[model samples]
Target chain A: MASRSMWRSLHYSAKRRVVSPAQYRCFSCSLRAQDQGKTDSEKMTHFGFTNVPESQKESLVGAVFSSVASSYDTMNDLMSLGIHRLWKDHFVRTLNPGSPLARRHNETEGQGWNILDIAGGTGDVAFRMLDHATNVNHDRQTRVTIADINPDMLAEGKKRSIATPYYNTGRLSFMEANAQTMPSIPDNSVDLYTVVFGIRNFTDKQAALNEAFRVLKPGGVFACMEFSKVNNDLFNAVYKRWSFSAIPLIGQVVAGDRDSYQYLVESIEKFPSQEEFRAMIHKAGFMIPGRGYEDLTGGIAAIHKGVKPLA
Target chain B: MGAVILARPGRSGVLSSLQKAATASSRTQCRQNHFHPPVQYRKQELPFRAAPTRSCRLYHSQFHPRAPTHEYTNSQTTILSAALEHIPSHGFTLEALTLGARDAGFLDVSVQLLPRGEFDLILFWLASRRGLLRAKVEENQFESLRSVSSVEAKTKLLILERLKMNQDIAHKWQDALALMSLPSNIPLSLSELHALSSDILTLAGDSAVDTAWYTNRLGVAAVYASAELVMTSQKPHADFAAIEAFVQRRFEDRTALAEKITGFKQYLGFVGSTAIGLGRSWGLKI
Candidate 1:
């Protein structure tokens, strides 16, 4: 009931037409708004819609993932109307592991593809990539490492992988590592680094991009598929209304968890638009090809690609 | 103004409409950042309403749109420019781009850097030639253009100057035209064409922010395209005189049509004012 009341107020606050200022600025809302100057370099970052200390965001996000880890895929299907499946499938196909596209210059020619799937905990993308490399390309040397910040999510992935042929084949690996800091991953070791529906959750998206740049070899590709700002204003309005109202309600009725789902919606809202994110990628020293992105489903989601410059 | 602002070599940060929308998006992001959103875009900030966006938008240069083909990297500049010399012999093919890669001291596989392949070579040729034409006009290097005073005649001079650039590679351009017309490449190709027309207009001092602006650019683009088509159909060096005559006639036709439209508009204005005066005489407030 408290979640329902919060949703009602948040919806009103987003509109700011029906709800009065006093009604919308609940105790925590005002605190977050005017509390900017206390931290140096403004360590305050968004946790869902409200601003929170950057130090606490990791744990807050971890809690959200942990609560929803088992039902993560199910929720994704429900929220995106199962369009995420098609997006992920298309993403892997675009990457097209084991193809000559994976080879950098000439060195990694015969060793097959070395791919790092960042924030890909569920093995959804990793499995598909391995399958494509195996069944489609007829190349058995391709390998995928799934990295995620949430252990619960990784565990869910590991559990799901038990039935697949890649379990004992040494083609799959999982790492519980944050996207912003993957210290265990050596520099320039990967040919293709992919982050699907991720990179937005990080407290500092630029840091994650820098990490991605650091890990990829020269001539290596970086691909990302994430929810992006809709190109059409009318479509964006409908998307916003649907996400804001239907998603949290669905979360509450199904998983009995509202805050996690609300956080998901607000984070998408807070994430940088496609153009802004492309600029960030450029600042991180990645060379992107034409427009840097391809809008899917009319920019409801976009796939951004960049290549590390071969100096 | 949507005019050409000359960029030094390897600094092709042209003002694309995408970048303009990016600036607008940053303002939207700024508004969305706060609970009580602050107003942006003060009317006073726009010093030159005639030029809706130019020097003013650079205040937020941090929000680079980073769109492709706008800002070529040093290596892309090197390879693409080197690739241009190979085009007359290689006819905008991958072989020329590969030879260019070798000439630029990069590996043969480095041609992969230009992912669009042969089409990228043609774009580099178009963009570099446009830049050259702008430089020629900017430095007042065109002796023919110095004789012209009005924007229309100067525009014709500039069009001929631009078309004359194809003398060396005019034979190879049919393939480039085919590549530019490909379904996938059409948007970028059309944009390059639009940029060329816009540059020619700006250089000719056509800053009328009205229907004339659109008509003038469209007229210039039409004349240039038809003239180039006529050039490609004939022998290169020998047919330039014919191409120039064709351009001159097209420009004359366009100017005549524009004059007719202006005369018609004036006639309509007279009728409109007469009706308004009649309404006033009938004691009706307009």
Candidate 2:
């Protein structure tokens, strides 16, 4: 209402022949642009604080991940001050991929869980789950399929996996796949679906969630660990100052890429609060456990879990 | 303010926020009627808002499509209830909680769900027993208690029945008592105690909604707490005979105290009226 009247006054003033800077942002221009938009039907989405065409966001995000692929581990350590490791560790342990109870079932005669780690480009979470399953459960039959949209990230992940005992173990595999649609991965196939710090980057979050629900077995779990809205005012202000100022500078100095880290920082702010995302999961037809999401480090990050309801 | 700061993902423009904040007086009106600009100006003016996600009351409600309003999850309840079976061997310790989680087919670390660690386990037992006590009273509220004459006698039966419910776990009750007395744990412990006493009052059909209602509940709480203390202290066995006699004597003393208070109130009322009558006769404004 306020903007409309302001525009009306600006219009009357322009009609009086007093050319103003407001004329450049005149509502008539926007109306003309809206008229043109009806012909093209271009959708827009947030790329970092800027609005870009929806179709272009994927490539823009891909470029950032490809650039940060090699130093992703180091950058994660630097950005969260190595707390991301603990968050990821807790995320995996919460699911407890290969526990003794599951091993005792022997339904498939020692055939293990079909874990799908989405946007698991650098294999940070995938490697941890495999390590946990091997060391804790001692059942080597469990397999993990790491799916990523970026080839550069997958290459970096492969290089890292060579350093661990899981290299070429046949228990680990990598595939190129978008989270929104994966024809290669069939329905009711996955036992555990994990996306850590990755769901926020998707162009269509609900579509991705629907795909997760489609791929999960009746009782499979969908777990996501992401940088969420910080709950504390003082902490959030300090974090914003650190992220908006310090992180880009660190990225510029160490990685020589301020833009990617800046995108990373803005993306965290763009992600939903812990509660909203939990509702999205619930809306996608998964049963929420407890309050649906667990806050970590004063809610700077949260773990959201949902189980596919069995009919 | 948190909601304001989180609005409009494309709020990277300089002039737009200033314009909105300066011109917009009421935020609730502004949020409901957002003025979206064209695609080109959206980045420079109003950000393209996503379809508003459904806002839910941040509390658990039956109609709300959220998790159930249970203090503990099904798995947690299973683990805790199973943990009760191991109380005789392991007491109210973490070992018992862990053993219970394992027996419930959960991972050893499943005990982490009980965030307060062992204290939550203790709270679970206390709350569940209170639930059991309610069931017991409701079951025999009329059937067995019709023979017991007065409300006092019926209330006595209820309190003694509650005390006897603790007999199976009497040996382990000492540790539960110690945990409940902790400063941090006292609030929950006291609330449980408050619930039990009130349950006894309502079950005995004491509908006194005046000051005596409070006194009655408090009286029951005192008698039960003291009697439970005595039961836990007795070695080799819980002497129900002595506990029953103790409850009987405590009720008798409570009745005497009530009579004294009532008599005092009546005497005070009589004296005040008499003084007022003398003032009226002396022509003062009584």
Candidate 3:
């Protein structure tokens, strides 16, 4: 009886709103508004009828980042519940981060290497990478340029960095940057480029790829962790319910902004599936020789990795 | 506002008559108002009060929608127009004829005509300059024949083939034009110029002809406007000598290209410097 009720709840929770194409457009516009940082232009784009301007994106993003930045590690713990950490861990594992071969061309030496993180909210990947990199070559110098178009997210990253031992080591810094027009970085300089939980937020994926490819060294590495398509029919059905029915309401209660969370749900649905995304990576000039999916409860979230050749 | 009947001093019949008279007059007035009232009339007769008009509603609603337009400089606009215009005119202007051979509908013919047409253009100019005025301009007309004759077959070639053609022609033009830039003391015939263009084009690195593979390369070329190669041997400005030596040494070392690009960037860190830096990094000799 409990299992049956659980399935029923999942179905209700993940039941799609069947958003009209018009609503989808409004949702997209609201997303664009969030990135552009416009508010009060209430001819507002609807993240689901909450009408927001393109200018409010920063503050809206800031709110989320501020709310979670301190607990970001906690939220990743609760939301994916502990799954996000494992996914990130898996991503690093696939990178072969400690291999002697990666260390040989360590042109970065004492001052270390450079990293460009796209939509890298709260500096999770940057912080995690710094932790792992230090273990690999303690004397090796490395810096992570953690950037997100969201100031709130960046602020959270900043706040969290101040408190972490990693931050005291002077290994990580935060900056506000659009995925499309990443600034202050030269071409072919970054050794590893990453985006975590942020790919679906971009308005133009190809432009983001072009920019990522632009800033990366010819043989740099690129990886991402995002919500992905679930593979098992039964689990997918349950996961869908959990996402749709409860996530927005949870947003309403927790973040006091149900609309933003609703936009999140819609965006995740619209994001390219895992295989389709692999092709995108390939198109972006990365040779994705290896790939793995966590298949978290039939694929609600996944980790993907792609690498630029080191020729 | 609805009309309100008022108490009046009169018998029931008189009251009814008065009410009827009032209704009759109001109906007539409403009819008059509906038809053609004076442009400006006194408002004393009307029982209902008027609402104030709102004018700001329209103006304050939203900002005027601006037309989205792609911004390109006049020079860029001119180049695009000139390139487009030349694509159909087989062999008139040097740039146009080359572009046309690539754009012309016949794939086989476009492929064949591109080299031949370019050769003819070079040959015709050479002959005219060398005073061999009798060798007819139309002497190599067969060069216009394409690899395929029909549009449907051309369509069947897929996007890959079209892309391949674009890359192939662009590479050919690159080499031929580079050689053409070489200070020529010897004037060759149309056939010889054609052969030389073909030979040089064939000799270029294989990756040069794959447009997909050459995204960075093409972007860099566009930045320099085809001056990248020429700039390698000759300095266009003050740092030309240093840049030439730096470029040559970097080319020899291969691995040092990244470091050299950074060096060039530092040297030329003026406004709009990224374009040049990006171009050099993409393996443009400059």
Clashes of each: 0, 0, 24
Judged by TM-score, which candidate is best? 2
Q: What is the per-residue lDDT of model 3 for residues B1-286, given as tens digits with 9 covering 90 to 100?
A: 1122333435477656755665566555555433444323322232111111111111100122211111222222222333445433332344453243223321111111112234334443332322221111124222222354443222222211212222313323444454455555123332333322222222121123123223323322232222333343442233444433543343344436556877888877764577778888998876
Which docking category, incorrect, acceptable, medium or high, applies to candidate 3?
A: incorrect
Better of 1 and 3 by TM-score: 1
State the lDDT of candidate 3 residue by residue for A167-223, as single tens digits.
656567777778878667888777677777777655557778878878876546566
RMSD of each: 13.6, 16.8, 31.9
Query: CA lDDT, every prediction?
Result: 0.70, 0.68, 0.46
lDDT of 1 by residue, B64-166 (tens): 3211223455566787899888888888987687667657765443554565778878878888898888887778788888888998788888888899898
Distance from true location, Cα of B114 in model 3, Å? 43
> Which portions of model 3 show Cα errors greater than 4 Å?
A1-78, A96-111, A136-139, A168-170, A291-297, B1-286
TM-scores for all candidates?
0.55, 0.63, 0.41
Error of 3 at A3 (Å): 27
lDDT of 2 by residue, B203-277 (tens): 687756345767777899999999888888877465679889988999889989989989999999999999999
Best model number under lDDT? 1
Candidate 1 docking category?
A: incorrect
Question: Clashes in model 1: which pairs?
Answer: none
